[model samples]
Target: MISSANILFEFICFVMALCFLKGNDKFTLFTKLYLGLVCITETSGFLWMMCTNKSNIWIFNIYILFEALYISFGLYHFIKPFKKNVKPLYIATYLIFIAVYLYGSFTRGFFKFQTTAIMVASVLIVFLCLYYYHNLMKSDKIISIRNNLGFWWVAAVLFFYFGSTVYNLFMNVIFSNKPFAYEILVYIMLTLNAILYGIWSYSFICSSRHQKLLTSSY
Candidate 1:
């Protein structure tokens, strides 16, 4: 169960939090909080499993609530400069996600994985990422995405949730019965986690660089 990809994800999240703590990104506070939560949840979930030898599904079910809120709020923050009117949509969607999660918890029970809620959350995040891109392009900005921390952040969300989604859709039918399939799926998820955190870590670095540039200019 312990693997390099898991190690990599944890390492990246830890480092990203460090970068955000010292950096002066406009959203540095939010960045640090989110990354710190990411690390904490991951560590706590692992330790709880090892200590009790119990299923971690319940923990993740709760984690998804915070996950959805944090991501939706973050997107709302990012998109504020472009469209103020659209901000309410994010708030409404976040409330919907919470409602959906509540429904899932009641219907599926805490012990089971709520794939429907997860899929809904994932779909919303992926859609937000696409919406951000569409707005980014519409803005006529000439800057490369590399310098845009928001772009990288959105991209990370896009890739991880989108990749996991395909698995979410057919995993029970295709991979549940096979012996090694679950293990392979776990690794695939780890890789996706790595991608999300790795890009996020770099985005923090980019934010730090820009923060320094602004300070030096002043």
Candidate 2:
């Protein structure tokens, strides 16, 4: 269900998607489309849970599929230019993530959380983001971090996934044992969503300014 914290996160993402319409970077637009899908899924889940008063696990089960795909693709898009040799590895990791997702969905069924898939995807994406950072630090050319959209975007992913590692680990345990853990989960989610969407929104704005600067230069 939609919480007060996540609504702001979704709004920022939506506003940033509209901002992307002004820029020429198709890759940025691609991420924006993914963001749109995320918002749609989240809203639908909220409405489903609220209206029916039933679990919306299935909705999120389906969402995790697209989440892995889009984030992997986005990572590939960001890292491809910098690390050619890692191209095959990125594709392989994405395929592996899909395999894991399918396995979890079919075996565990959609009525429950895709815990295994989420955990695996989280660890894999963190590694990918770490690899990107390593390459960025090693690059011969000097660049200001302020101008690096990819850095901010990847950092957002890293922060969210890495921070959620513990939450993912204890997700089932908390729900089963701690009756009042919803508040804790809400704040954790709030922090994660804020960090993820906040950095992404800033990155889009940077991309916009970059487009303008390049056009002015030309």
TM per prediction:
0.89, 0.92
Which residue window of length 10 is worst by lDDT in model 1?
19-28
- 68-118 in candidate 2: lDDT tens per residue? 888888888888878887768777877888888888778978688988888
- The list of candidate 2 runs beyond 4 A from truth reads 20-26
Clashing pairs in 2: none
Off by over 4 Å in 1: 1-4, 20-26, 174-176
Candidate 1 — what's its lDDT?
A: 0.77
In candidate 2, where is summed lDDT lowest over 10 consecutive residues?
A: 19-28
lDDT tens digits, residue span 1-218, model 1: 55445755767776765755364554666666766776677778888888999987787787787788888877887787788798788988788787887898898787878788888888888888888889988986576665677888788888988889867886666545665677677777878887888888777777667667678999
Best by TM-score: 2
